[model samples]
Target: MNYEGAVYRPPSEARSLIIQVTIGCSHNKCTFCYMYKNKQFRVRKIEDIKNDLDESRIQYREVKRIFLADGDALALKTDKLKEILEYIKLIFPECERVGIYTSPQNILRKSVDDLVLLSSLGLGIAYLGLESGSDTVLENVKKGVTSSDMIEAGKKVVKAGIKLSIMVISGLGGRELWKKHAVESARILNEIKPNYIGLLTLLVEPETEMFKQIQAGEFQLLKAKEVLLETKELLNRLTVDGCTFRSNHASNYLNLAGELNEDKERLLKQIDDALSWKFGTKDEMYRRL
Candidate 1:
């Protein structure tokens, strides 16, 4: 078994594997992203992906899960995605589940039946980027999906009985719009009540729109402490039913995990205690990080 296209593995993968099917983000206009900027989007030839799947099965016979990648695998047409999913099952019969990074535009275009068919084919998870729920911030970031659109997309996934993990950027709106960012994000999360709410704090890389904004003095990058405050504000307003919350990314100042409804207050207090610390120095915060 030979793979024609290049393969990239995430540092965090131990039991998980990423199978690249596309080259770049289909909708790569997000201001905060620089992940796949240098490449153009293209769906790999089906035979190439099938070969990779067969090779992966041979190399990692004990693999339990797989994540399709190269920005957004869901961007592939439904029948094409279905073929890939079925090929995965055929090669990795013991594989328990499969996940993919999905764009809202792609998800919106998918009918519930298509999602359900995919789910029944062993597609267990969909990681959606719901960066900021404030329509203004979404527009500014070029997210290409409104808060309402995101909510609808989320509901459809839930209705299809598939697990939905929505990722939100903590400091996306920066200082000027921090309040709205947190409040609207919380409101959207509550309405959607996705199975998992994952958070990634903003990290500026050169050549990204966000970087240009910062250089032009239009966007204010928050200090680590300020990020913690914004996280607290979000946690304060988030009142969803029973979604699990996670902020364990290395980019985040603090990592927290717990059930949303039961552990919301506890997590908020953790943030408050960290922020109120008169540890009296920027050095202290740096030391903690």
Candidate 2:
């Protein structure tokens, strides 16, 4: 595939065929993000994307899932997205599901009707990052969305019959607002009750603004114990059911996975073990973003 720069997707989408529909993230101003810093944001030409799809059809046999990458593929207009999805259905008849990175702004810009139309066209899931549910933390990191915005966007995806996979950063609020971050995030997730919740711990890159803040003592990094404490609070407040939850990301200190409510106690106990030094935590040398 003709990729412009670094491509990222949900870990669950590891085996899917990745197609770069957009060059970079539409809003790359988030202080914690460094993924698209080297690339400019732009949607590729319809014909060029089609060409890549055509080439992939010949190179790969029996492709089942496709993930649209290069940051927020859902930014494309409904008509344009419909055209690309239609072509995918035409060429990859066996493709069971399609997924994409989505931003709250993009999700809200498109009407419910637009989202439903795409869902009917085989767009199976969308990944949204709700780094922190605290409005102060959101504005601090420049995520460009409030907790309300996150809830609205998440509900829209669920309403459209599209699976919503949300990412929540464990220590985005750091020491200053850790409790608020944990409880408020759980409240937002409880409201939306997304299909999946992928928990990630905060780790700053030197190139990003967050790194500067840390150096200046403006923000704090939660230690392993504090992270577990925050996570425990978050999980404790979560009352959602049937949603898949995973915290085994490379940046995380703990590894956790299970269905919500059903395995809530088990997950909390695992965190307690880690906090109490009974269970192991990932070493800093091996932990990464």
Candidate 3:
């Protein structure tokens, strides 16, 4: 099989399949993201995408799940996305689900009909980078979409009957607007009440605008303890119904998992226990690894 030119799959996708149908992120303007900067954003031709699927099926037939990449496969036109989905179904008839990363800006542009069509074509889940629900925070980070826009867009996606996984970054507003970031983000999540809420701790990758702010001492990054406090505050404010929460990344100093309705109190207790123990010590941070 020709593995050449295919991007490496992230370890996070060990249980899923990776299908590259796009070259890079459609909106690479988010300040904290460095994932797609090395390449320009463009959708691959349907034939090329089908070829990649053919190659994958030749090696591992009948996979149950897949993740379309690079960065926001939904950015493709609805017809193209549907064509790829049809090819996927033809190739892997046993495939049960498929997901893709999506930018709120891209989603906002899509009509409800387009979203419903994609959902009906087996685009089961979407990973959305709803970094912050504070308009100020979003603009400060150049997220390219406002809090209201995200809410409206998220509502449409949900209305289309697709499972939504919304992600927010802790410490995104750094220290200046930490409270706003936490509160506004929680409010948005509460409104959307997505199927899943994934929390990501911010990391300033080199060459991004955020990294320059850090070097110039313009943005004060939150301490690990400070981030935890902000996370706890955000969690305290989130009152979503039946949402699953996860911060399953090495970047997070602490990991958590809970359902909104069933384990909210338990998750809060876990956070409180960790906090009361004076846990954000340097030792604790390293030990979490």
Candidate 4:
């Protein structure tokens, strides 16, 4: 299959067939994100996408899932998205689900009826980055949406019967506002009650605004212990039921996964056990590695 630029999909969609329905992220201005900085955002043409699907149909014997790439494929018009989903149904009858990354703006702009329509057409799950629930932190990081907007967008997807996987960064607010960040993020998550919660620790890579901020002393990234504390606070405040929580990303200092409400106590204990280890201070232990 033909491809353009770097492709990214949710870690859960690693085994799924990936097609670039759009190139780059439509909103590529988040200060902490460098994912789509190298490319311009543009929607791929319908026929070109169909051709790629046609090619993939011959190359693979069976495909259980397909993920639309890159960034926000939900930015496409409803009719166009419906067409693509319809074609996917026509060509890959055995495919179980289709997933895409979506921005809060895209979700908010599309009415629930539109999302419901898309869901009926095979758009199964959506990945949204709710970097922080603190509007101040969201503004500081240039995430381009308010916490309320993020909550509304997340709920919109859920109300439409689409599986929502929301990602929240552990240290997004830095040391200054970490507590506010944790509490507000948990509150927002409880309000939305997404099907999945993905916890990621912030990684300030080169060539991003965040790196410049750190150089200029405008941001203070959290230490390992602080991150664990923030995670615990966020976890303690969460009351959502039947949601899968995962923090297994490579960027995370501690990888965790479990169902919420039921596994909350066990997960907290796991963090406490790590905290109680007599080897050394949490920061020092991590630093020695």
**Any residue pairs clashing in model 3, and if so which?**
none
Pairs that collide, model 2: none
* Candidate 1: worst-modelled 10 consecutive residues by lDDT: 3-12
In order, the Cα lDDT scores of the candidates are: 0.84, 0.92, 0.84, 0.92
Q: Write the per-residue lDDT of candidate 3 for residues 114-196, one digit (tens) a residue.
A: 99999888999888888899999999999888999999988888999999989899899998999999999999999988999
Tell me the spans in candidate 3 whose CA falls farther than 4 Å from its real position.
Answer: 1-12, 279-284
Better candidate number, 1 or 4, judged by lDDT: 4
Prediction 3 global C-alpha lDDT: 0.84
Clashes per model (N, Cα, C within 3 A): 0, 0, 0, 0
TM-score order of candidates, top first: 4, 2, 3, 1
lDDT for each residue of candidate 1 in 98-160, tens digit (9 for 90 to 100) = 888888888889999999999999999888888999999999899888999998988888888
Give TM per candidate: 0.94, 0.96, 0.94, 0.97
Estimate the TM-score for candidate 2: 0.96
In terms of lDDT, model 4 sits at 0.92
Least well predicted 10-residue stretch by lDDT in candidate 4: 280-289
What would you estimate as the lDDT of candidate 1?
0.84
Candidate 4, residues 158-242, lDDT tens digits: the string is 9999999999999999999999999999999999999999999999899999999999999999888788889999999999999
Clashing pairs in 1: none
Q: Could you tell me how far off, in angstroms, the CA of residue 181 lies in candidate 2 after the best superposition?
A: 0.5
Model 2 Cα lDDT, one tens digit per residue, 60-115: 99999999987899999899999999999999999999999999999999999999
